[model samples]
Structures are given as C-alpha cells and as structure tokens.
Target chain A: MSYRAKVPKPTVKRLSLYLRELEHRVEQKQPTISSRQLGDALGLTDAQVRKDLAYFGQFGHPGIGYDVTNLVDRLRKILGTDRTWNTALIGAGNLGRALMAYGGWQQRGFDIVAVFDQNPDLVGQWLENHRIRPMSDLAMLVKERDIRLAMIAVPADRAQEVADRLIAAGVRGILNFAPRRLDVHQAVSISSVDLALSLEQLAFQVSLGLLGSLDEDDD
Target chain B: MSYRAKVPKPTVKRLSLYLRELEHRVEQKQPTISSRQLGDALGLTDAQVRKDLAYFGQFGHPGIGYDVTNLVDRLRKILGTDRTWNTALIGAGNLGRALMAYGGWQQRGFDIVAVFDQNPDLVGQWLENHRIRPMSDLAMLVKERDIRLAMIAVPADRAQEVADRLIAAGVRGILNFAPRRLDVHQAVSISSVDLALSLEQLAFQVSLGLLGSLDEDDD
Candidate 1:
C-alpha cells in the first residue's frame, strides 16, 4: 500500500519532523502553513523544507502555502505510519518491559503484539497484555502475528545473535536499542537508538557551552 | 580538563563513531588506519572523515595515516568521554532501571550516580547501586554530587516539568528519553532519544523496501 522514493536519508528524517509540526498545527485548528513558518519553527530554511517535501511530491501552493491537513495526510502515508504494524520485542529485561508499557507506539500505529526472551524465568510471564515467550517460539509467533518489524533490547553480547534470529525468523525491519552496531542483510532495515551515545553528545556540547539551539532532525 | 569547540553537531556525532571504530582496531592491535579504511568501516567517505577529524586538530600522517590508539584518546577527549561524568536519572520506572543496568555508560565514561522518582511508594527503593530518591532531594543531591548531567526517563507529560526542575538544580545537559519535545533555556543542552520515532522511521523504510544501506551518523 506504500511506495518508495529515492529520498535522501536526511530528508526522510525531516519528513517525520514536519509531520510532528503539522500535527501540532492541526491540534491548534490551523488550516494552512507557509514553508517559512514551518521551517522557522524547526530551525530549518524554507528552501530546505520545500526541497525535502518535493522529494515525495508537490504539496505546496504558490500563495496559499501548504494545506496543513492535506500535507499531514500525505506525510502519514509516505512515512508508512497511516496503518497499524504489528511488532515484536526481544529481551524481557527492564528495557523490554518499559517498551511494552510505552504509550507512544499505539498512538503511532505500531503494536508490540509479542515479547520474546532467552531466559526461562521470564518466559510465560505476562508483560502488559502479551506474555514473554521464549526464543523457540519467535518464528512461530512472528508468522502467526504477521510481524515484519522487531525491536532488540538484549545486552551488547547477545544483540548480534538475536538480530540473526530475528532476520531468519522473517522480521524485515529492526529498531535496535542495544548499544551495538548490528550487521544485517542488505535487504533488511535497521535503526539504532544508543542511549549512552546521546548522553555523550550532550556532554560534548555542554563542555563546549553549546546551546543545541537547532533541534537537529535525527534518529 | 575538557574544552569545547565550534565543531558541527554532525561531526561531533561522527567523532563518537570514529572513536568506537578506532577502539575496536586498537583491541585488534592494529597500529594505524587510513582515512579510507576508517570511513569505510563507518559508512562515511574518506574526505568526510578527514574533514570531521580536522575540525579538532591535525592527527593524520601523510602515508602512515592516523595512529589508532592516539586518535582514540584524542577523540575521547574531544567528545568529553575521556573523564567520568556524574549523571542523575529522573524516574525509577522500567526505562530508568534498564538505563541503570546498561553496561555501555561506564565504558564510555558516563556514570549514573543518582536515581529519582516522584512516586512515594517507589522512593527509597534500591535500583542497582543507587536508591530511588524523592524529587525534593534532586537539587540538594545534584549540588552535593556536583552533577551537571541528567537523564529524564519520566513519562511524556512530566518531562517538561522534570526538565525545568533539573535545569534549576544546576544540571547543564539533559539526555531525554521521554517522547515529548521539551522547551528549555538556551544555556542547557538537551538531546532526545525517542524510541517510537525510531520505530516509525524503520517502518517507513521497510514499507518502501528501502535497504537502509548507509549507516548515517545521526543521533
């Protein structure tokens, strides 16, 4: 139901940011927005905003600027967030439990329908609404639930092995929370969320008295 | 002592990646690496690598390239990861507990020395080495520990309030794990790690059959 375009990765990330801003405007009952206003709010130039949006398709009006509601719909579809996606979470540790209870995913059309862990003690225990299943059931549950996306919260040493298993079990996209760079097949997609790396960046900026004035659109 | 530089934010992020790759090479007893080799490992161009490194100082040799061990040390210093940073974690929930147990922080010179929560029942609870303290103790403990960095793992609704309190408590940098975008003064540095946004990006790429070929150096 979705199509791919040859958009730059940075542009793709900015699309999400624009969506957030547009959604906020929608909540405020705003009907139209100029690229300059949108870019100013996000610390980006109006030309940059126009070019990034142009990569997908034309959504801007000459004088009316962009129709806020129309652009929001197109962005949601382009980001593949318009439909619900069933996702799997591996690792029943604190990170996994926290992710299970995270309220943001359901609001964004992602539902973590299954949880898997290697520990025998954690297996069969219920976290939120789903039970913590063992690794052996990963393939079966993935197929049963039609899960194409998975999240890895395992430790550094176990992340690679768990990723291998997820790929073999038919999970196509992975959101890795472990502080490790995963090597996956070129056909699959992976995004890493390194918590400590984020803190380190903050430390570097703080040490230099950087204000982080511009909210960089990044993962 | 650590000093700040006017380095671009993207370069700052890539410096961390270079440090990781260099440290790995050091462990393997590799003496030196060319810009091409280092950039290849991190999915960056050789010129890009050289430019990023050049922002701090000259470290590359004509033929011998960059000294692995020395570059690692220099990058660690430049990124403010050479010395331990005392940090406080606000929120003793599942996310905070997982962050407490994360092994990557210590290796990278960040130590989460304090844990705080607003819930009275969770207060005084022991998580790892630190007991959960009430919010009333936040300012005093931050002063007593000389803590300038903090991690906000609180829920989205409470993130802004917690950030205000932390900034008032003399924290200079914040690594926010909450999904909300916080408004803070220009003096303090803040970085957000939105887990659901990472998932949404992955879903977008997966839906479009994008390979995620390039490991973009982003937060």
Candidate 2:
C-alpha cells in the first residue's frame, strides 16, 4: 500500500470513506464484502468504488470480492490511520472545545495532545484533561511532543495569525474551523471546515426546491 | 437567476465560493474583476470560474469582465443568500453551543430562530438570545417561525433521533454535525460535516508527502 503513483485527491477522500464502510462491516463480523455492497451502502457505484480502491493497489479477488479484515488493514495503512497522530489545538473557545470533545478524531487515530490559547484567563484553566497553555509555549510543545498537526478554531480576524504561529512552530498540517482564508507557506497543508459554506449549499437546494433530491454525506 | 436548468452540485458549491470572493472584492470597493483574478485567489482556473458562473447566467461583457457588485448580487441571488433563512438548532451540548456562537451563519443569511434539547436542565437555559426549548416544542417552533432549515449537533447516538424529529417537524433541510451516517426519507435534504473525513484527508496528504501540492476546494 506504499505510495508509488500520485493519487487524485478525490480518490484519497473516497478511500477514507471506504475505510469507514469497511470498519463498519468488520464490526458486524462480516467476513468479506463486494464492491457492490460497499457502493450501495455509501450511495456510490460499484465501478466507482473499484476505481477509487485501485489507486492504492489490486484489493480483492475479482469474483469473490474483498476480504473485510484484509481490506480494512490495507485501507487504514494507506490512509495513515494505522498509526496515531499527536495533534495540537489552538484557540480554546467553544468551537475548539467542541472539536476537542468530538470522539471521532481519537477513534480515527488523531490525538489532541496540547491545547493553546492567547487569553490570559483561559491559559491556566483545564479543558477536558489538557491544561490550556499560553501562545509562547506552542513551539516548545510542538517540538517536545513532536506534534505535526494542529487545529485552528480562532476568530476570522485572528485565524491567519494563529496559522502563522502554527507554521512557525513546525506544524505540517492544519484543520481550520475559522471562516477566513489563511495564507500559508508551501510547506503547510491546510483544510477548512467552513460551516457557513455547508449551510449556503443547503440554502441553494432549498431555494431550488431540490432539497429532497440532493444527497450529501460531508459535514 | 431562477432554476431553469439543474445546476451541478459542484457548480453550486463553487457558486458559494464565487460569492465569497466577490464579497471580499466589494468590501475593498473594487468595481470590476476578471475571471483570472477571481480564479487565482481561490486556487481555481479562469475557465473553471467562467464555467461555474455560466451555469447561473451570463454576467459582464466578454471583454470587460464582470462588475464586482453585479456579480456579487447575481451570485448571492442564485445561491439563495439574498434573503434570510430561519433555522432551528437541536441538541444544546457543547457542539450546539459552539454552532450558536458562530457568527458566520447569521452574517450569510441563515438565522437560528429556535434551540431545542431533550434534557430538562438545558431546556430552560438560554444559548445566546434564544431560550432553549424542549424537544416537544420543535414542531410548534418549526411551524410558527417557518424554520425551513435545522442543524443537528447532538451526540452520534442521538443524531438520528433528532433528525427524525426535525423531519417530522417539517424541516426541509438539515446540517448534521454528528459523526455518523443518517438515514432519512427522500423528501428531506441532509448534509453532514464529518470532521473525521477532513482530518483523514489531511492525514493522507501528510503520509504521502503530497500535502504541499494537493489543492482542494469542497464539492
């Protein structure tokens, strides 16, 4: 499952979806699953599922389909979910706390090891299990804990500043919940979960009288 | 800009992006913008931008490009952000509170008119200005307030339950934050914002050393 060719971003995302589906099947004690079954569950076509999985390698037998356990392991390894990633959370506000409280991240191998905030009042407080650290401690904690990923949940005006700090602190990737576009160096990878964007999409469907027909799976 | 033809989902999402870019240009008091400039700012191509905008309707002259204000207004109308949409929030937990605190929704036309929770303790509490109501009152609020959209921020186990209630209460569109697949009838449009999916996408890039090169905008 090593990366030999450039996989399309969409294919990579579908791989994550397939992994989730496969995990569910494994939980049900299913021995193997065909591409058709997987597609039906996720509202995708079987050929599309096969095409996405092919980006990694030949997965399962042609007629018998994919062994649930083996495919799960392969997809997990390909997705890098096989190993735990230590992450840092910046901005201990409501959004940040909600993200921290989300249990899926831990289940999928992302651990929020450190929490940081600029407010003096929140700096000494404990959120969940982690003590809120000051902004000055970011670089040090990133180095000491070897945190390569960070989540930004700051205000729009402060998103770029926190991103700059995270980048300078040696974070390679960031998942931003802030509603502002962040300008970053080429080395830093950023993904934003824009709640407004999703709502606007829903609004478009509602306006067009297409709300009932459109199927969406992404949050 | 009425729905004459079915717009592709990807185009609809990009329309939102175009509106955001145009709003930024308007704030700067810029009078006009070409497709190339808009595309560059959002990591899209000039032709792609033109194609997306074309789905709604023609804008600007061929040689002069689009007027900033005209394009913004057209996009806003096409995306249904021209008027406010009344919304309801279910589940008054940390995530629900965080969503209530988010200012972008109201800024971009989605208004949270009512908040509901099943827990008796949270039922009487106030989140922001809206007094939290019990689940029993959802139907009444939906009808009285004309709330066409609902946001579900409950725990994963409770997400489906709340979604059913919202649908039963006559909510036409839903934005679910709970990290699980929701089964709903065809008449209800639902979109999920899976934080785990976004993190896994980032993880895939970090693992493959492609984090720096992959450019992603939502579909």
Candidate 3:
C-alpha cells in the first residue's frame, strides 16, 4: 500500500522538474550528479534542491552525490511514472489532435488509449493509431479500458458538459486544455492549462519594463 | 509607469482565476460578489480569497461586497490585460495553429502579430490573418511591430534553437508550449506548459488510490 506523504504542491512540482532533469542526465550517460549541478541546470539553488529531495528520503552521499541510475529509479517509483497509465482524450479538434501527437506523454509512460469527439464528421476518423470515437462511446470505453484519467480539449462552452460526462463515467483526474474553470467534485483532481493566463503574466512583466534587462548588466 | 508589487506567485495565479470568475459573473448579469460567494465558486476558502485580494488593495467593504465592474477593470489593469500586446508565434504546427485560432487571446488583448516557421512548405501559408513567414524575417518584423513577447510551439529538439533566435531578435518574454526545459538568460521570462508533467502528477495521485474518497467523506 502506498502511504500518502504531506508533500506541498510546490515541492511536488519541483520533484517533477527534478525527474525531468535526471532523465536528461541519464540520456547523457552521467552516472552521478551533485545537487549543485542539478540545481544549476534547472535554475534552482543547491540548498533548495537538497531540501526538496529530503522530503522524499535521503538521497546521494556526502561527497559523491546521487547515483544517477538509482535516483532515477527511485524518483520514477515515487512519482508513479514507472507504471503505464491509460488516458482518454475527449476532443478531436486541433488542440486535441496536437496533444495526441505529442511525443512527450508516451515517452513518459502515459498512453492515450482512446479518443472521443462530439462531431459526427470526426467520428471514425483515425488519429495516430486510435480511431476517433463518438461521445456516446465514452462510458463503455472508459469501463472497458479502465481509464481513470482524461484530457479535456473541447471549446470553453462545452468544457463543463464534457467534464460532467467524464466524472459521471468515473474519471477521477482531468487535464483541461480549454480556457475555462471546471467545477469538479472534491474527489476529482483537475489541472487547467490556461494559455491566456500565461500570456497575461508575461504582459504584466513586459508592461513594467522588467524584461530584457538582465543581459544588459552582463554586457 | 507600472509599479511592480511584491505579491506572491500563488496570489497572482489566484487573481487570474478571480478575474475569470468575475467575467462569468458579468456575463450572467451579476453586479456584486462577496468574498465567500467568489471563494465557493472557485473552490477556495473565503479567508484565502480576501487575503489574496488584499495584496492589491481594498476591493469590497466589510458587508457590501465588491462591485463586479470595478473589480474586473482593476484586475485587467493590474494584470496588464487592459492594453493590447503584440506577440510573435515561432512555430506553425498544430499547436501553434490551435493557439493562433484560440479566441481568448484576442478577447484579452494579445494579438499574434506575426507567425514564423523554418519549414519551407509552410512558410508562405496563411494562418488566421497572419502569413507564416520564414525565421530569417523574425528580426525585421519584431522591430517593425515592436513585438516583445513570443510563443514557442516548436518540437522539443528545436525549441532551444528557436528560443535563442527569439532572444537575439530582442524578444523579452516567451510562453513556450514545447515540453522542454528552456535555458535562457535571467532577463527573459519563459513559462512552459509541459503536458506530461500534469499527467504524471495525476498518475501519482491515482497510484496512491487517493481518488473518489473525498466526496464520500463529505457526504
């Protein structure tokens, strides 16, 4: 049984970043890495990296640093990425198709087992290896494939409708790409990717004339 | 001149959420909103909402609540969405096209002034209203349009190369859709949307069997 740790959300996010950095190190055939080295790569301080890792467990040695292969395995197990997860995609539009074609999800062990769309024109069309199915088939497919996670890419107006259906079909996690706030039940986890929010933050910084000044000091 | 506040990042994110909720309220013809009502709508605590808004300044009186029109205008100005920002898109693939077609950006005052691609086949294609130009013309167009913000939706392998070129062309802020960690100078602000990271976090919760129990307890 997996016991829950009281890991802060920020720490959880940092762990994901660490896992990504470790994957890169593994690709480069680096056998070990110091906290400073890993921190430098991700723009974090060494103390912050060590502190974040300490929340999980003790890792690395006093002088030799962390064993790359062993730490990677540990992180994968901790993050639950060592096992494959079957996911359902709920829209077949441009955003949905782009997500289906994204190589990163499959590379990191999340598989899009089925695709669903509301439009009859898109139904039965092939996307990658999976055929686009209709919304009517969602319940049956979720049960048959044991899909507990879903990705919502429909228009903002339809996002809530699709989410209601997914939750009713027993999906417990949703990654929403539509720029809308979803009122999901407490038991369900929903992460939203608001593209406009990011742009607004950037705009706020630019408005303050805070961008492009770092290189000036260096020069 | 726009003054930067020492607001926490989480507070900034919540402000955006509050802005979205207020927009919906406006659409529904609701004029004023209390902190408790707004908190309940967004799954945040009333106290938390009050504290977050307090970072900016006083919004509502003790009992009367906030005027929706005033709050929305204040948020827009604070977030820099009150003014239009000309932005450049550096990849003309599916993700780029989806973002170009996203109506929320235009509604919130971000205009995709130019589109760029390294692929010759797509260079001359028209997306939305902007023609896809070659990367060689990025500097000239950025200068001509005074574009300081860019969005990168290129493949992971080419993301860094495109980012380097964007920086060299005098772009200061980037909203990267590519699932890769970008290395940039401290002066440039980059926000990344890694789809896999969200999936992995969901998988971790699912693995721990932490789904569907909250509502049961609540009920």
Candidate 4:
C-alpha cells in the first residue's frame, strides 16, 4: 500500500525534510525528539510538526517525544525511498546536467541513468556514467531502461511537448523546471520547481520590513 | 502591509499559479472569474479556492466573481513584485554558471549581476555581463551592487558558512540549493530548494498509487 495516499500534499513535502533531519539526529546519538524540538530544529512551530506527523499515524508520544530511528524508518517507508527508483533527465542543459552531477539525488534514492538532448554537440557527450542521447531514442530508452520518472528541464516552449512525449513513453511521475504549467494525462503527477516562486517567497519576507536593515544578522 | 504575511504557505504558492492564469484571463477580456471557474481551470474545488483567497483579502464577489485586473494587481502587490530586484550568485559551479546563462531569472524580475567563487580557476571568467570574483571580494560586491538577493548553488557542506557570510554582509533574501537547514537571525528569509525533494514527492505519489499508469501513449 502507498503510504502517501492517505497524506496531504503539505505533509508529504515536509516529510522529506523531516526524514533528513531525523537521520542526522539519530547519527548524533539522540534517542528521542519532541514535536517542539523537531520544529525548532527546522524553524517551524511545534504544532505544525505534530500536525504533519499525525497524518502518518501518530508516531510521537504525548510527552517523551519520538524515537529517532523509528521515525526515520517510518518516514522513509512512507516516502517510498525504501526502494530504488531510476530517474531520467530529458534535457542536458546546464540545470539538467548540474542535477545529474548533484550526487545528492543518488544518496536520496534516485539514479539519473540517462540524459537526452536535441543538439548534436551535447548528445555525443557523456554525463557522469550516463551518455547523452538524441531525442529520437527517448521511447526506446524509456522501454530499455524502465525509467518511470522523468525530469523536464527543457526550455519553457518545449516543456509541454517534452512532457507529453515522456508520458507517451510510459513515465508516471515528472518533476518539471519549466516556467509554464504542463498539461498531462490524469495519471501523471507533475511538480514544478518554479525558481521565481522560490525567490518570491524571499521577496515576501523582505516586504514585511521584518529585518529591513542589518539587525536580523545579530542573532 | 504585506497581504502574503496573512495567507497560508500553500495558499501563497497556489496564488502564484492563480495569478498567472488570471493574467491570461484578463488578456482574453474575460469579465470576471468566479471561484468555481478559477477552481475548474486549476483542477481545484470552488470552496477550497474561496478559502485560499479569503486568507489574504476578499477579492471575489458574493454572486459574481473576481475582477481579473484588480485581482492580478492585488496578487502582484502581495507577492512583492511591484518592483524588480537585483540578485547575486555565490559559488559559480555548473549550477550557478548555468543559471547565469539561463534567461529565466531575468524574466522573473531578478537580475543575475554578480557571481562569487573561491575557485581561482573561474575567478576571471565572464558570465554574461558579470565576471566571477574571488570570495575575498564578496562583501564589497554586496554593497557596490546593492545586491539584496543571492542564489547559493554551492555544495551542501559549504552552504551554511557561505550563507552566514552573505547574511553578515547584509543580504536580505537567499535561495539556497544546499540540502541543509540554515540557522539565521529573524527578519532574514532563507529558503533551501532541495532537488531530491521533488523526486521524493513523486515517489510518495507513486507509493500512494494516487496516479495510475499515466501516459498518453499507454495502451
């Protein structure tokens, strides 16, 4: 059974960060963590931490906090990183190439096994262990490599078409970096990493005049 | 004064997408948009849309809908896009260098005017209009260019120290690609965008089985 089916979108996102932090705590020989403790570590509120964890069947105690090792394992299982997944990068652009080289993706349970590009210059090159391929071979690659997840880092204009092709090739999940929202079939779950939105999040905080000057750096 | 400080995190994210759609509606000369119509366009519920928007300020009418032009303006102001921003980038790795070359950042109101790196190999290289500089010159760059925002695409281990230096130098907002939490004083907004989180989100979706074999070409 998919553990995520029962969880909300916000809960799922927070679980990834929480899992990482829990692993760190476990390594530090911390035996238990309270909701407030975890929240503090992440700059979140105690209630928010408890509410997010509650979605996955109450892993925390009333007062003693949560067992570090157990929470990590439970969250890992819920996030489906208990198994390995083969991820394909559809564009060999700078962002896609950087992602292939990031190294954290592998540690987090993903392999960028193949890369694609339409340009002759890029297609002939090798990225890490994977070789870049011409776009003509995408379908063959999807079948041969059994890649179920595709990351679309192509330009905005081609993002939708590239996504359509990835879906056509049987990929079920897509993480899009294009500025535009992509249209996909009901079965495809696309999550866009809008760089603007990330920056805008900061801009909103700046507008608050919270630390308009240098006082925020004192702590 | 910030309409976003009152809205939920998820609501703010959805508003970005909503504003994009609202702009299109305005261009098409649509009279107004009802909560139901807005929800349908984005595959959400009418009540849910109402709830999300209500957190900011009431822009939708009781019986009719929202004024596209007015709503767009409200969203822009809430998002803090009333003026453009100049951004600096630290650690001109492949990711940073790629971002400098990409035109998307410019369109999003952030100008990539400066780059910093400790690697002497890239110190003299030109990225678009800006030359990569040695780390020693970071503080001066922040002041001379009036750089309020920065993008840190450095390695995870170096992220905190680099961010600390940036914060110390008076950077108000940061978009970090580092996979760790940053401890900073209040008023300074720091957001870390982990590449693996998006993949994990997809994995969670797959494990949950909310999406079936989604592909346009799937038989």
Which candidate comes out best when scored by DockQ? Answer: 1
Name the candidate, 1 or 3, with the larger DockQ value: 1
Candidate 4 segments whose C-alpha is farther than 4 A from its true place:
A2-5, A30-55, A58-67, A210-219, B2-7, B43-56, B212-219
Q: Estimate each model's TM-score.
A: 0.92, 0.89, 0.81, 0.86
Best by TM-score, which number?
Answer: 1
Q: Deviation in angstroms for A62 in model 4?
A: 4.3
Error of 3 at B124 (Å): 2.4
Q: Write the per-residue lDDT of candidate 1 for residues B7-75, one digit (tens) a residue.
A: 666776676678878989999999999999998888788888998888778569988899888888777
Residue-level lDDT tens digits of model 2 in B114-213: 9999999888988999899999998998999999999899989999888888888899899888987788866677778888778878888777666543
Ranking by DockQ: 1, 2, 4, 3
The CA-based lDDT of model 3 is what? 0.78
- lDDT by residue for model 1 (A139-199), tens: 9999999998999999989999999999899888998888888888675888888888788
C-alpha RMSD values across all candidates: 2.6, 3.1, 5.2, 4.9
Candidate 1 TM-score restricted to chain A: 0.93
- For candidate 2, what is the TM-score? 0.89
The local lDDT score (0 to 100) that residue B157 gets in candidate 4 is: 88
Q: Provide backbone clash counts, one per model.
A: 1, 4, 0, 1
Instruction: Please give, for residues A61-104, the per-residue lDDT of candidate 2 as tens digits.
Output: 87899999998887777667889999999999998889888887
Whole-model Cα lDDT per candidate?
Answer: 0.83, 0.81, 0.78, 0.76
Question: What is the two-chain DockQ of model 3?
Answer: 0.32
